[model samples]
Target: MNMKEANKKAVEIILKGQPTLVGIGKALDVIPGMKEDIFLHAGPPITWERMSGPLKGAIIGGLIYEGKATNQAEAEKIAESNGIKFAPCHHHDTVGPMAGVVTPSMPVFIMENKTFGNKSYCTLNEGLGKVLRYGAFSDEVIDRLKWMEKTLAPVLKEGLKIYGGEMNIKNLIAQALLMGDEGHNRNKGGTSLFIREIAPSLIRSSFDRESVAKVIEFIHSNDHFFLNLTMPAAKCIIQAAEGIKGCSILTTMARNGTDFGIRVSSMPDKWFVGKAQDVDGLYFPGYSLKDANPDIGDSVITETAGFGGFAMAAAPAIVQFVGGTPKDAIRMTLEMYEICEGENDTFKIPALNFKGSPTGIDLAKIIETGILPSINTGIAHKDPGIGQVGAGLVKPPRNCFEEAFEEFVNSMEKELSNE
Candidate 1:
């Protein structure tokens, strides 16, 4: 097929299955493998020394949560001895945020893209700062995980059931755009909108008065909670678009606990990768660049699909995280529009005077601009055993796309010759 045909097919696949949450008790509420007792990690597998601070903490916490070991020291021995297999959530068709691992039994969010009828899953947000998603696994973090599983997940699951159909994420994303949420790294508005849509059902669910209070409090307190939902929603949407021949749409972005990689629609299972960059952003007290590690996780796909650092202008408040001026936010989002295929009429940005948000990174345009995609990410300490220590902005190495493009061109030529 011609390049135009390939692009059209790719767009078709992307539009086919956008995802949404529809039920209670899905795995989304639980951390990775919380219920299964088998915790999984992000990207490809690596040795213990390669793990970041937050990732290490997450592993230790997973051990604690799973009753695999009594303490961090024991957990380290167990992990090194191969008592627990090291596999990527991506291998399971799932994505984890930092050292993302899901033990079975944890309530997980289940998102379905009705158009393509495909599904994707992820665990709930751990409420930031020394939490599992950021690679922290402290006692405090462990306790919070327990509370989320035992209390928050059940209540929200019941509440979510009141809306029997999928949450219309496409529409929600559109609304969030106008409200100053780029969906990733800055989901304040999107989180609020999500709570509002699910609130009616949540109220109707059988949560006790105290549970209701707790759920309400939790939702109000954590701005990133909705990020959990958005990740799966975006995952479900993009996964639906995978596997269209000649369609150069990106289907995945992941770090194998070592390297950052991406997959395209046409190259379904093949990976085009770049060295993961270190994060450069604000850090919690007692943490600095010295403690940071290369970028890790499956969440970068959110930005790749549009709305993380790319849509920063919609969420100028994000400047505090990545340390850029308000103008930089606008420029970032604007630049993304140049690489993307079209504007999402549904997701509008008031900062851009109601301009539709950018959607679908266009390979052709990306090649033309010579600007690699921008992402806001958390930083893990280079040393294994330490978890996340900071957060910052990063751009995918250009060589990745350059290599992929050359291969794609060669593949097309082969097709022409065969024809």
Candidate 2:
């Protein structure tokens, strides 16, 4: 098929996807390629020698969390020892936030694309500041992770069973968008809705009252608690677009602290990478750009699927967190529309008279228009243990799309010559 026809087919599959949160399971059990010695991080793969500090730190924490090491020094040693293998979460049909490490023992949300019969997984959000996803592995971080494993996961798992097998995430996110969630950096609306939907089932579960109360409190306190859910849901939607021959639409846009990468729908295995860019936005009182790491996380999957940054106009309040005015938010959304194939059917932005969100990043459009996708994200400290320094806006390096577009043209020309 030609590029236009291929892109239309791919975008339709993405829009038609209905990702449901089926349940939660240990990383070793539910994630497709998970294994005891395997560690999954965000973005395209990188080795210990090339890994950024935050990515390396998360790997150390994962080793310690999995009992393969006793202390930081030991964990660091084991991580680079080759006995522990590192892979990207995307390789196994999963997604995660900053640093995005998934160890064997960690509990992860399981999302199934009810429309496509595919699945995606993500670890629970650890809240903000000095958490594992940001590469912090202090005593409190490890302790909190233990609590999530022991109490939180089970409660949510049982709650899902009580919720009659699954919860439709598309409907939930659609409602959340109307309620002021852009389904990315700002998810207060989605978290509140999530709690409302699952609380009844959680309360009705056999777990005792105090445990349920703590779980409720934990989720209530963290506005971004719903982020993990959205990441995998987006992944479930976008993964459906893969394997479509001649499609020039982008199936993935991700960053490991060291590299920004993109995958074309027709060439999913070929990663076009560029150096990760520094974020430009608001920081905590004492932190500045010098303290921030290059952009990182699987969270950009939200933008790739057409909601996060693409729907910024819907959440004008996001500026309070990511640093920009309401007009800036709307401007970003308008700019994104130029690079995408079309607007989303499920996620509508009320600020524009309930217009559908711009969805499906089209590589051809990026090449033709020279406009890039912008993402709002949490800022992590350059060093491993400092955690989140702030929140901000970022865009993937232009070289990534430039390289991918170059290949797309070359591939198409080769096909034409042969024909």
Candidate 3:
């Protein structure tokens, strides 16, 4: 089949499936291991050695929260001694931001794309700066995680239950784009829309008024709460296109502290990998370039599938962190359209005159165009123990995609001969 035909088939398959985390886990065939008492943020089973600082910090904080360890040092030793197994959220067909850590006790969002019956999963955004995803593991971070476990998750679960059924992430994402959210790096509009959707159920849930209030406060305070929504949305889209024969669409992109791995639509289940790229962006107070970690996490699947840094025109505020002017952001979004298969009509961008955001990256086009996908990511301190120290812009090395394409061509040749 030709590229257009392959692209169309891939989109059809993706749209046919509903996105769910468990479904993604089943699809990817990996179950993230979680501390029986501690909660994780994303994906199936990970080991401590495979974890980045932020992930490690999140893990240590989780140990303390579970009373499994008394302090960071103790938690570190326990993790090193094989007490914990590191896994990628993507391994479980899930995604997470920054450290992308997930524990059993944490509340995870489950998105089902009803159309295709597939699902995607991710942890809720923990607001910004010094939060767990950024790699800060401290009493304060642990305390916040406790509050989310004890208060926020329960109430949100109750509220969502009352609403009943999967949230329509596609529609929310479309609206968010128009309202000024890139759906990654910047989530202002998406968060507001998410609040509006769950507010009524939240008000009626059996959780006490204070509990509901706290949930509201948390969502309102974290401009990126809707990030959880976008992650599943991307998962929904990417999974929809999986398993298409002869297709070269990228199915996954994730980091495991030490390396970044990718899977393509054509290759179905094989992983193509490279070293994680370093992030170069603005820093929080008391942090600098010296402290940033290389890019990590399965969250890049969102951008690769369309809508993260690729849709930056919708969230120019991202410029402050990732180093780009508003014009550059718009250009980036527009440039992505050149390499993608089509526009995601559901996710419209007002800045682009209400045009749909670019969607479905085409690996062939990327190779032909020589344009690597753009990503906005949090920077972890290089030292595994320092955790997240900043945020910025980076690109996956072109070689990974190039290698996947080469293998895809070889596979195609073999199939042709068999025919």
Provide TM-scores for the models. Answer: 0.90, 0.99, 0.90
Best by lDDT: 2
Worst lDDT run of 10 residues, candidate 1, spans 28-37
Candidate 2 ranges beyond 4 A from true positions: none
Q: Regarding lDDT, does 1 or 2 come out ahead?
A: 2
**Global local distance difference test of model 3:** 0.72
Q: What is the lDDT of every predicted structure here?
A: 0.71, 0.91, 0.72
Candidate number of the best TM-score = 2
**By lDDT: ranked, best first:** 2, 3, 1
Q: What is the clash count for each candidate, in the order shown?
A: 32, 0, 46
Instruction: Put down candidate 2 lDDT per residue, 57-124, tens digits, no spaces.
Output: 78877787778887888988777779799899999998989999999899999999999899999999
- Which pairs in model 2 have colliding backbones? none
- Residues 1-419 of candidate 1: C-alpha lDDT, one tens digit per residue: 76667766655555555667765354423333333434677765555677655567677788887678888899989888867766667656566777777766566777778787776777888766557766666677778888888998887777766676567776777677677677777778877887888787777877777788877788888888777777777777777667777776667777744677777777777777777777668777797877777788878767755566767788887777776778988888888887776665455678888776666776657787896777877676555444556667877767778887788768878977898
